[model samples]
Structure formats: C-alpha cells, structure tokens
Target: MTRIKNILSVIPLFLIAVLQAQEVEFGEISKEELLEEKYELDPDAEAAVLYRSQNTYLQSSGGGARLITEVHERIKLYSKNGFGHATETIHLYKGKSARETVGKIKAFTYNLVNDKVVKSELDKDQIFENEYSYSYDQVKFTMPNVKEGSVIEFMYRINSPFIWNIDEFRFQRDIPIKRLEAELRTPEGFNFKQTHKGFIFFTPSTEKKMDNRLGMDVVVTRFDLKDIPALKAESYVDNIDNYRSGALFELVSVDIPGTVYKSYSQSWGDVAKTIGSSSDYKNELDKTRSFKNELDPLLQGKTNQLEILKLLFKYVKEQITWNGVDGKSFQNGIKTTLKEKKGNVADINLLLVAMLRYAGIKANPVILSTKDNAIPLFPTLDRLNYVIAHATINGKDYYMDATEEFSDVNLLPIRDYNWGGLLVDNPNKVWKHIGRIAPKKADNMHLLKVVVGADGTIEGSYQSRLTHHSAYQFRERYKEKEEDEFLNDLERKLSNIEISGYEVKNAAGYEGNVTESFTYEMENGADIINDKIYFYPLAFLRKEENPFKLEKREYPIDYGFPFQDRYMVEITLPEGYVVESLPKNIVMNLPDNLGKYKYVIRHMGNKIQLSTIFDINSEIISAVNYLDLKEYYNQVIIKGLEQVVLAKAANGRDTGSTGNK
Candidate 1:
C-alpha cells in the first residue's frame, strides 16, 4: 500500500513537469481562465474588434467615425541572382466574423517576390480552417529597387480580423494548421535593423524594450548588423485557428460586425474608469481661478491698451503651465480643463475663454489642432487639438493664444494661426480665416553733431531711435541681458564713435510700438584733403542690409503682424563743409499690392537728413503674388545698400576755419 501511494504521487508530479516544460519551450497561452474571459465578450463586439477605426469630428458637425478593411499587399523585387529577391503578401480581412470569411488556402507565398513566386509556380490557393479560408486573389505590390529609394513608398489598406497595427499576429492550439513555418530572406549576414520611422516586428523572442514615437511602450524583435543587406520575412498564416481565428470567427454570432479596432475602441469606457479626478487637479483649478480673479479688475481698467495687453500676457503666461499634451482645445470641453488647470490645447484655450468671459469681454474660443499634430477634421467634429481666444475690442477681432510665451494679448503666434480656424460663437458657426503673414519691420537712425579739428580729428554727440518690430525683437532677444550690457553692446557695434552719454527713451517697456532714443559721441572717419573731404555713410547700421534672412521658406514670412517702421537721422556738417552727394530717395512697392517702402535723403544747408519708412498693409498676401513680392523686396534690399558721399570745401575756400571753429 505504501509503494502504491508513492507511485501515484510520482505520476502526478511527472505530469506537472511535462506541462511546465511545454509552456516554456514555446510561447504558449495555457490559461483556461483567459479563454473563458474572452469567450464571455459579445460576439459582435469581437467582430468589431478586427476593424480599423478612425475619428474625425468637430463640435460644429458633431463627430464622425471611419472603418477600414481587407488590405491586400504584394511586394516585388528585381535583383541580380546573387543579390536574391523576395515578395511578401498580406491579405487582411476585417469586419464581423472577419476570420470566418478567411477561406481555404492550399498554398501561400513567403519570402518570394511575384516574379520568384510565379517562377516557382507556387499555388495561390485558399486555406480553409475554422469558419473561413484565407484568400489572396487580389495583388497589390511595392517594388523598391536600389535606384528608387526616395521616389517610391507604398502603403496598402488591409482588412484585418485581428487588431489594427498590432505588434504581432498570435496563434494558439485549436484550429488545425497544416504548415506552421516561417521563411526569412536577407543578405548573407544581414540582420534586422530597428527603426522608429518605419514598421518592425515584435515577437515572443524580442528582448529589447523601446518607446514608440507616441511615447508608448514597445519591444524590438530583432537587431540589424552592419553587414546585412535587404531583408524579407514571411510566416505561413497561422492556422491554429482555434485561438487566433476562432476568436475572430466567433464574432459571426453577434450583431456588431466590425474589426478588432472597433472592439478596442469599445473598451475605451473601461480605460476611462481607471482614471478618476484627483484632489491635486481640484487644487490647481482653484489656484488658476484665484489668479484670474485677482487680475480681472486690473485688466478691465481703462489703461493704455498696449500696456494692458502686455501686462495681461505676462500674467497669463506666468499663472498657468501646460501639461504638455495636445488636444486641450474646447472640443475636449473647457469645464474639464478648468477643473484640471493642465489640460490639452482645447482645455487651456477654454480656460482663456472663460477668463475673458468672466472679465465681461466678448471672447470666442477658436478651435484647431496644429497641422502636424492632428488629422484634418473630416465631415464631423474630429481631430481638433488646440484652441486660442478670439476677443473683440472696438469692433476688431483679435486672435490670442496665452499658452504661447512672450506673445502679446492680441497677437497670435505664427504657429497657432495656420490657415483656417473655427470661431466658437453660439449665434455664428462661421469659419474665420487667419490673416496673411505678418510683416517684419525694423529701422534705426542716428544723428550726430561733429567738430572736425584742423588736424583732422573729430568729436560729436549723437541721438538715435530704433523703432517698430525691430525694437521688439531686440528687446526680447536681450531681455535676459543686463541693461548696461545691452547698451554697451550697441556702443561696441558703433565702435568708431566715442560715447559721451546714452539714454534709452521710450525703452522703459514695450508698448505695441518699440521706440528708443539715445545720445552718443563719434569721431569722423574722414578728413578734408585739399578741401575735398571724402566720406562714406556707415553701411554697418544700414536698415536694408538683411532684414529677411531666409533664402526660401515653405511657409509665409511673418513679422509680428501688420507693421510700419520709420527712422530719421540728421548730421550737422562741419563749418567749412558742403554736402557733395547724397543717396537718392528710393521706394519699393510689393507686386501684389502687399506693402511698400520709402527711403528719403534730404540735404539742407550744412545738415543731412535721412528718413526711411516700411509699411505692410495686411498679412495674408496670396501665394499667387509671391513672385512680385520677392522681386519687390530684392529691390528694397539692394537700394538700401547705396551710400551717401560727402565732400568738404577747398583748402583756401574757408580760411583758418576749423570744422569746430
């Protein structure tokens, strides 16, 4: 009896060991619990799981969805015999019971290009397994040769009963799979190279962890070696249909007939359950509210509009920080953003809208996802990503995105003002167009009084003004630098001049227009030689040298917005000197009537006056007018480099008269 009991125990232990060995030998699913859980899901829901789904909607149009299916792909390779060639075929079937539609397959091609497969005369038959046979009558192909790397890129749509863009196709024991095999074709010693830019396989054998472009976790199935050449991989469609196909086929009994994508989407509710509002979020919203309330009265006051704008911008940028995700716009709902303080694009913009509304101002929240970040909204409310506020002041609409740092209250960052925007207003569902590109305006002028001694020495005091967009740029770029450092740097750039005293007028702060005036001293670089003192205008400070540095741009060039710039300089000539030549006044008008420039030079008695004005009427000049605009700017920059020549009186013309004397 003792020996029999021991034998029984040994038998059970041996069975357990065998089972354990099988589980580890190959990546297998052995959980009966998992199987039961899967079976319990709705069959129609299972079918929907296999479909590809996309959302494209907007608040105006409600929202929309798209389902994709049966993607067929064939790749052909032409190669020298030694180089080897291959083709891969993928026929994905999606929809309710998509797997049930996969019919009988006698033969399938693997690692063999169309030419090779045809040459081998492999049977393109259907393999019947569970409730379906895999069929591949359709032939779509990508033929990439060494010569056409940049010119050819191919994509195909396939109906997959499984998940869309799944990392791997898994199969388990259940349905009879006749030939479970895999074939790989690559350069003699080539290995797979992992890349984030393109698709790759993640298999049970993969050991490397990686993060995808979307910041999602993933793994690498294979690594590439330098010596490797082209690569091709194929696996006989897994026929162990019981788990893979059976799971897919079972969907036929259910009413929902979609793809695995639909199934996953349906599970979004479950995901939402895992995320609940936290107390931290509540606290952040309260702080944002308190901050807004504190600033309300100040903003409402009849302060200088520009000063108010600047202050408002500073306050908003400082008050709230972005959580660094897109889609925070109003479409996601502002209440959620107000509650979270750190919402996506829509959320933050909504908060801006709420603040403006609370301040008793007419503000509309404009909705749009940045170009690269979200898909273009289809017919419905979809793909909206970010938001900005549209405020109306004195019958003028101003677009503002406080989320962008350094942007003034009414100014929209170039990134936020793309092509079109939907302004959210209850009575009006109109799509408002963002104006043309902003114009860049910058101008600086210096006037100096100089005394030239008999020995050709000189000294002078100078006054100057740097105005318009140029002023704003200089300030922003140097905001971090000390005031003395900034002025010192300017003095250094005008090094030929000796500085006596300097004052930055209208530089206390930036108010819509940046205007600065300063005083300085300088020595003349030229002296009278036989009364013909030759002098050249300093071109280093020339306003037109290189205003537009970009050689070419895919998008429009923008200054801060509509802009105007003016610079005037006056220089008191020496006592015995008379102006010889002066730069001619030049004007450039944009081809499409976009803008104009005025260059003026005036000579009055012993004084030289130089004034320049650049004005851009509007932003969105049509692309059709690019050629004319380009030509116009070319002329302006060229003429801006022209010099003003000066000549002095003859040696005896003014006897014993020092320029200062």
Candidate 2:
C-alpha cells in the first residue's frame, strides 16, 4: 500500500508538469488553442489575444548601452471580422545619426485540419517597410493563411540606440486579452518616472538583481493579468487610447558613480526651456529677415494691433500651405519653408508667430498634443506633437492655426481643441486652456415651408443657416464637391426625396454664416387613411436615434465645443383638411443647465407650424452624469417622433378657414 501511494504522488507531479508545458510559448502551436471557437469571457468578441509577453531591458554594447525589447503574442480568430488582427505593424523611430531597428521577426498561422494541427510559416518576402514620416518608419506583415478558427503568433525584437525613448506598454486593447505578461529591467544608473492611466488598475511586482552581462545591478518590474476585458469604445470620445490601461516610463535623470548626474524634464519649466532653446524651434523663429520684406508692406499702414494680427495671420495662411504633417519642431528651416510655399504644421504656424511678433503683436508658440495623439499626462517633451500660434490683443487671447482655410482668429481646428496646451514663452511659460474657457458656438436655424398633397406626397422649401463651427464644418465638407454631387449626397441621406433648385450662400467667404436653400418633393411623406392625414412635424430632420446608446460609460463625452440647433417648420394642410390634434409642447433641461431642448407646435387655419431648439452648453460632460445625459437625449428623441393628425373638413365645407385656438 505504501508503494502504491508513492507511485500515485509521482503521477500527480507528472500531470502538473504536463499541464504547465501546455501553456503558450514562443515558436509553439497547440491543438487546443486552434480549436477554441469563442472566448468564454467575451463570446461576442471577433478575436482574442490568447497570450502576450513583453520583456524590455538595457544591454551594454560597444562602450554604449542600447534599449532592447522583445515581444511575443498569440491570437485566435473567431470569424472573418478578426482577419484584420492577422496583420501587424511596428513603428520605428529614426534620428539624424541613429535609428531604431527591428529583427528576428517570425510569424505563423495554425488551423485544425482533420483533427490535427497544421501550421504555415510567414514568407520573408511578404514583409514590407514604409517611410511614415521624416522621423518614423513602419514595418508591416500579415500572417500566412489566416482564417476563422485559426491561431496566429508572432515574435520580434526592437533595438533602440536612444535610451530615453521608452514607449508605453498597454494592458488593454480593442480585443480581449486572455493572458498578459510584461517585464521592465532597468540598470542602476538610469532613473525613470512611471505614470499609469485608464480605469483598470494593475499592481506591478518589483525586484532587484545583479546582471553579469552588464556588470551592474538592475531593478525588474513585472505585471501579469488574465481575462482582461477589451476597452469598449463609445461615441464622442476624444481619443480612446487616452483611457486605455497602460504604463509609461519617462526618463527623468541619469546618474553614474564617476560621471556628472544629469536631469531631464523635471517640470514644465524644464520642458519649455529645453524646447525653447532648440535650433529647430526658437532658432527658426529668431531668423525672420526672409519674410520681413513681404510682411512690412502688408502691415505698414495698419496701426491697430488686432488689425495687424489679422493681416499677418491672413498673409501667412495665404502664403504657405500646410503639408498635412504634425510636428512641434520645424523639419526644414523657415527660409526654405517660405521659398517652397508648403511646410508642416510647425513650419507654417511658427512662421505665423514670427511674423506676428515682428508686427509688434504679442504672439508666442503654443505646443500641444492633438486629439488623435491623446492628452499629455506628464511634463515631457515627447508628449507634445503639434504647435500653433497664440496672440494677445486688447487683453484678449486669440489662438490661430493657419493650416485650416476656414479657421479665423480665435477659431482653431477641431483637432487642436484638446485638453489644453503649453505656451512656450522663454522663461515665462504658462498653461492655457484652449476649448474650455470660451465655448465655440454652432448656431444653426432651419426654416421649412411644406404643402401636403391629396396623394400623400409632400413638397417643401428648406433653408438652413449655420454659423461659427457649424459653418466651418459645412464649408470644409462640401466646399470641394460639385453642387450636383452635394445635392445627390443630401438626397441619399434624406431618403424618398428629390431635391431641386439647391442654392448655397457665403460658402466661399469665411466671415459669414453658411446658408443653404433647396426645394424637395417626397413621396409617402404623409399617411392618409380614410379622411385623416398624419405626418411628422420635423419630417426628415427629426431625431430618429439617440447617440448615447451605451449602458454605462467610463470616459467623458467630448463635444469639442458647445452647440445649438434650431428648427422652424411649417406645413400647409391639403385642401379641405382641418387640424384635429397637435403634439404637446415639451421642454427638457439637463441638470446644471448643461443642455436644454424645447419643442412647440401650433395649429392654425389650414396650416401647422412647429419649432424646436436644442442646445448643449458644456463642451465636455463627465461620465458621472452620463445617465442624466443619456436620459435627456432619449426624451428629446421621443418628443421629436411625435406626429400631427389632420382631419378632412366635415361635408367638404372648408371648416379649415376657422383657426383652432
């Protein structure tokens, strides 16, 4: 009996070893993984990350240190929708003298064939490289033979000469992750500040060890998580990545036993000082003789500071065209940019600032991260990606971006209306809120005149006026399209309608509101049953769906700017028809006056008039109030769907001549 017990104990240990070996590993494909059709945690997920591991450390080579990171990931596709996950792109940063490099890339796709695992290796020729910009390049590859019920895995290593450039390690993505493992090993000399964001909280285990290869002591931080849900995205979010659970490391200082200690970006002042002294930034602004001759003539007779500022802004906008590149530092010098007549954001906006300063207007450069880049969480130089011009006239601040043709003084592009920005003014750097202090209004009014026919068809004349951001968006979207194309698109949006006599005013000028008027005929716009006619008050302009559909939201809703939309509609009843009933007038207001909606309808002799005013005064609504906002929108949608009922006159005796009070 004792001998049997010993054998049973050994068998349990053997089984444990076998189970441990089944865990995912690099260069290994398992039959069980390939057979998994759906993830238990998120059954609706199109794909899932089965396992991921990332290890980053510093290695000493050739009397210098290089940052090395190794990554391995395994993913399973549940349907064709997940095929997009089969392709991977790695971004590499390039500098003037040294650039980051990737090597040792291997990928495979495994699928079950006749109850057996079959794997296809990626071909080396299938990998391709593209130059993303002057400072970045990307390498992309697709796994071979990827399909539903297939498991794909890839591993690669990146070697970076720039030791301070450490990218964030994200724990959450658009797809669910079953298992994750990450480690960061830093030597004793380098000091880094770690920052974490997102709704998920992760605690890292840290340890210290001696490294024989580097001949130094190092600290290791490790993170392990399982069954992490995907970061679900909702509407009106500025940047979903900003709310993703991740850890970022920023190099703060470097210290060596026998060498001088150095500090970097210890505060906002340090960041401003470092960038303000760079040749590509402040140096470019200092040399203004190249465009002085042209600017002098434009501002010679202009004595008003605001006028001079406007003139300089217009001159730079008309002179240089944006090349659609975003950078805080100029790629080419201002002289070359001026001569070429086209440059990146920094090249164009910085020149505008220089010209404004030369014109004796107090202007400076405002460095910020665009909406797509996410808000900067720390005071680091790399956190900022774009720059614009800021000027103060008559004690009022005006932010300008010359890249946008429809943008004017104090009206910046929507992308630049992020959290805030840093004003780089030498030693007097200050943080300024861009979109919060003064809301950008989107005032719009719609007037409609309609006639109901006996055949249930409707003819209407519609006119819309848009101002501020609304006008800017209208001009930006339809400016390049032909009138006929625009009309066709409108018709497609408002189904069952044929538009004619479409006219637009103030589309070519940036100073006034955009006006659009069109005549349209719609079939089946009203329902006529026996002697009664029924139709919606707002017609095609009614709100059919509420935008806030999520049960809960963890991120704030960013509207970019406050807006108001108003509609005034009138419908002349068909001949011999009298109004029987009208939808009740309703008014709803969000808490704290963040938003409001009003709808009123009136019945007159042979006519029905309806008006609605919808407005949101807050640029951003916090997630804490998401339920309130969602309910408010639901009520608005419900009210907009209410219909009006019209009854045929009794005895066909034109009782419609008497107004209903």
Candidate 3:
C-alpha cells in the first residue's frame, strides 16, 4: 500500500511540474523575438493572473496550493447607470513542503472618499487549511468601497522594472493614467527600442541577463476595454496615473488584486538578528573595534587640526566604499560593514560617523533620499533612505558622501546633491538640515592670439581655463579612457570648429581648476556678402547643446547645485580686415538675484574680447522659477551664437570679393 501511495504522489508531482512549465509562456526572450511578438505580458504576469480572480491568494506567496492573503478592489464606474466591476484576489505562497502550517497571509481594501484614497483597511482572516486539499492555506480579500462618479479611479500594486540600487514598489493612481509615456533611463552610449506594448528592448541584448542597462522589463495596459470618450492620453516621469477624471474621480483597482505575498519572507530585523547572533558577526565586530588614526599622516608633526581634519575626511571617503543600496539584511549597523569592507549607504556613512566619533572629531550622519527616490522628510522614518557624513572643521561645516568615488571632501556629486537633505541625529532623535548642493562656479578664460593671414584664415593658439564645476564635469567625461582618446573626444564635443593641430594641458589631476591650451588653426566660416562677412560665432561652446529638455511637468525641476559660468573669448582679427559689427554688450540681473547673466564685448585694436558670465545664486529654487530660468537660457543661447561681422579691407583697390576669403 505504501508503494502504491508513493507512485500516486509521483504522478501528481510530475503533472504539477508540467503545468508549471506550460504556465511559463512569458519567459525571457531575445530582443528580436520580443519585438516580433504583438502582445506581451508583464514580468509579474504570474502575480497578475493570481489577482484576476476572487477567492484566490492575491497577496500572499506562502501558499502554493492554497491562497492565504488577498486584496479586494471594487469600483463603481458610473456615468449615469451604475456599471461597476469588483475584483478580489488572494495571494498564496507554498513552502518547499506544500505544508499548510508554513503559510502566511494578509489583506487590504482601498477606500476612496471624494475621489481620493483616504485609507487602506487591512483584512483579518481565520487560519483555514481546508481551502485546498493538497497542504493548502488561504488569504481572503473583499472589494474596495467607493462612491459613484463620472470616472473610476484607484491605486494598483506595481513592481518596478528597474531594480536600481534599491527596489522600488509603486502604488500611484493619484491622478488618472492616459497615454502613458515612460522613457527608459540609461547611461550614455546605450540606446534602446520599444518591444511589444510596454517593454523596451535594449541594444546588444545579451542572453546572459545580469541586469546592467540591457533594458528593464515592464508591463502597462488599459484594463477598461470600453474607453471613455472624454478620457485622453498623457505621460508622467517616475510615476503612472490616469489622465481624465471628469469631476469626482479616484483611481482604485476594481478588478485587480494585490501584489505582495509571504513565502519565507525575511524581515530586516530578523536577518540582522540572525547574522548578529552568529560568531561571524561577532568576529567582524571585533575587527572594527575602533577606527585607526587617519589624520596622523597629514599632521606630519605639525599638529595642525585643520589639515588633520581635511586628511581625515579624505581618508574616510577613499578607504570606505558605499554599497549604494541598503541591504535587506543589514540592520546591525556600521560595525558589520567595517569588517566586510563593503556596506550599504546607511552602513558606510553611519560607520564614517562612528569613525569620526572614535577619532575625537565631531561628525554626524545626514539621512537623505537620493534624487531618484524623492521622498519627503516629515519626521517619518520612511523618509530616510541614505546617509552621508557631515563634519565641522574650523567653524565651517562640509558635507561628505563617503560612498561616492568622484566626490571631494567638501563637494557632493551632482547626482546625490538634490534639493534638501536631512541630518538624522542617531535613532529616534531630532533632525538637522545638511542643506542643498554647493554653488559651483566655473570661470572660463579663453585667450587666443592668432596671426590671421589676409585670406581671412584665423591661425592661433587658444588657452582655455575652466574653474569649479566646469572643470569637475570636464574631468568626469574622459575619466575612463586614455589621454589621447580623451583629447580626441574633447575636441569632437567642443564644436564643428576644425582644428588642424591641438594640445591639452592640466587635464589629468582633478584636485581643482583645469587649464588646457591648444594650438588651433581654423577659418572662421564667415560668408562675405557685399563686402560684409557674417560670422555666425557659434563659438567653441554654443547654445544648441542646451541640456534642459523638460516638458510641461508636474514635479519640480531640481538643479540640486548652484553654479556660475564665465566665458571669455579673445580673438585677434587679421591685420587687413576690420570689425564692422560686434555683438552688443548686455548685462541683466536675474530675478530675486537667484542668478545673473552678463555679456560684454570690447575691441582693442584688431583683437576683440568677448566675455559672457552666468551665475546661479541658489541650488534649491521653486518650480515657478523654471520659466524665468528657461527664458534666461534662451537669451544666453541667442547671445552666445550672435554673429560678429568683419569687413575685408579693400585690397588697395575695389574688386569682386570671394565668399571663402
């Protein structure tokens, strides 16, 4: 009898395996194949299916045979008649042994009040293993309660396609979702094309998917087959929403279920305790008992505190590496990270704070969410995502992000230096503001002494000095490549100005301001029309390379850091030719002194000096300032490319002039 029972179990197991394989129709596919397919499902299609039905495990992963937890979504889509759909789902996770005892569950219902999600009520259930005969448990969910409206609205569970350094789960339906436009964010040199409805296929699509920028998997669809005539399509960055909600409208998942589950789900505290409970954690703790003296070398027997502090800041940033993302398991704090040589943002920065404290230096951990995260700090623990160390030396405080490799002791990378950062004073303590980004000032001085021939050919050696932010950005561009490649790339990016010969100086060391002097020979492509040669004056740096490409946006445009840009170009005209028209000298003060722009042109004999300066006084500005900023940029661009006409000298007598000359 036992042998017969074993054979029966084997048959069901084999059949179950077969079903699992068949259900996986939407596995990872090549870009070519993905593009070929007309309709594709989301990566979480498996989860989506579970949410499609009522009495199904909608939000629990612990029950394989029996769904234990679920979220019920109900909506009343009413124009005149009540045509509303209600959906309930139960999510279940089955353990390694399809045992009912191992199952866990939870449930919730979205509540909408006057077209807004007022609250979510979690469901309570009794332990029921009788839901499924095969070692099963269950999660129960009911439909969300909502009022009648011209439009249906609610929030739905969504998993992020991009697994940044940290995982992001979205439940946005604050507004209606229309023509959804989501651009795949990626680093430079990489390009991608859309595949299927919501998926974008990345270039060089590799079989070995390890997740770089090889494109992220996404799922988007309009569930209501009957489209509303008034509803139009729209797009939003970093979020999904409904576009048209006539009067009283709130986005509520009517037919969709929840997207969370339990299957041996590990909690942060649990993971930390388990690890910290072991000898490994103890051994690691012992290793980093105290931070070594990082400032001794800088002192060099002088005992200068300022220099020592600087050295200490530099050492911590260089020696400690930020893992960028917080580990799901690392709750024991910085001690665990110190011994491992690698830790999450919180771990590393907190460790740095500990180190400073150990070294008798005053340092505090500043908690902040990176620009991408954009969580508001309202005294809630949820707002704090990452940490950076702030230290005061000689009565001046400097922000230090130890995780970043390119950041100096006082300077934060533009990427992390967003709007505002909150400095958390340890656990359960008052918060302090670490402030926003620093004012990056770039003073560019270009002195070109060219011996122009009578043929209108400008031959000169140009020395360009870039200071502050400009130099920092310049160093970052060719940081990965060799010297020759860097120079070639730099020249190419500058402009269409043809350089017959060139040289680069002060390009390597990134401590501060960089000065590059290059020998250049180029004809200022000026067309002489009726003795008036119009020089476009696109300049080495033109406005066509404008970076702000934002559209009508809902969120605020954050520059993060303030910056000042100064451009000075001195060009020596040919001995025979004379300057007929130089760009007008213009100076304008920005609104509220947030920034300033100045353009000055001075002609000293045959040489003309053109200077342009734009300075941004503040980093954190309101969105209302965007229009002014945009307008300022527009003017700067027009002025930068403004032409300077040079008339050729009548060659002893009057004759037909050549456009080339």
Off by over 4 Å in 1: 1-318, 321-327, 330-348, 369-384, 393-398, 426-471, 483-512, 520-531, 543-560, 618-634, 637-641, 651-661
Best lDDT goes to which candidate? 2
- Count of backbone collisions in candidate 2: 0
Q: Write the per-residue lDDT of candidate 1 for residues 1-661, one digit (tens) a residue.
A: 0001121121111100001111111112123211221222222111101111111110111121112222221211122321121232344432223321222221222232332311122233322123111211334222333121011112233322232122222222111111222111111111233222112222323432322222222222322111111111112111112112110101111112231211122121221121112222122222345545566677766555435544555655666666655543232344454445555554565566555555556666565545443223121122334567667777766666666544555455545544455554532333443433243334455454544443445455555555554555555755767977777777677654555455555444554544444444445555556656544343334444343333332223433345555555555566776666666777778765578888776766666666666677664454355556566667766666565445556776632212210
lDDT of 1 at 157: 35
The TM-score of candidate 2 is 0.92
Q: Per model, state how many residue pairs clash.
A: 56, 0, 38
lDDT per residue as tens, model 3, 619-638: 65555666677678788888
lDDT of 1 at 527: 52
Preferred candidate (lDDT higher): 2 or 3: 2
After superposition, candidate 3 runs with Cα above 4 Å error: 1-176, 179-302, 323-341, 426-453, 498-510, 530-532, 545-554, 650-661
What TM-score number comes out for model 1?
Answer: 0.47
lDDT of 1 at 207: 37
| Model 2 per-residue lDDT tens digits across residues 513-607 | 99999999999899988878888878888877788887878889988888999999988888877877788888889888899998878876777
Q: For each candidate, give its TM-score against the true structure.
A: 0.47, 0.92, 0.56
lDDT of 2 at 239: 91
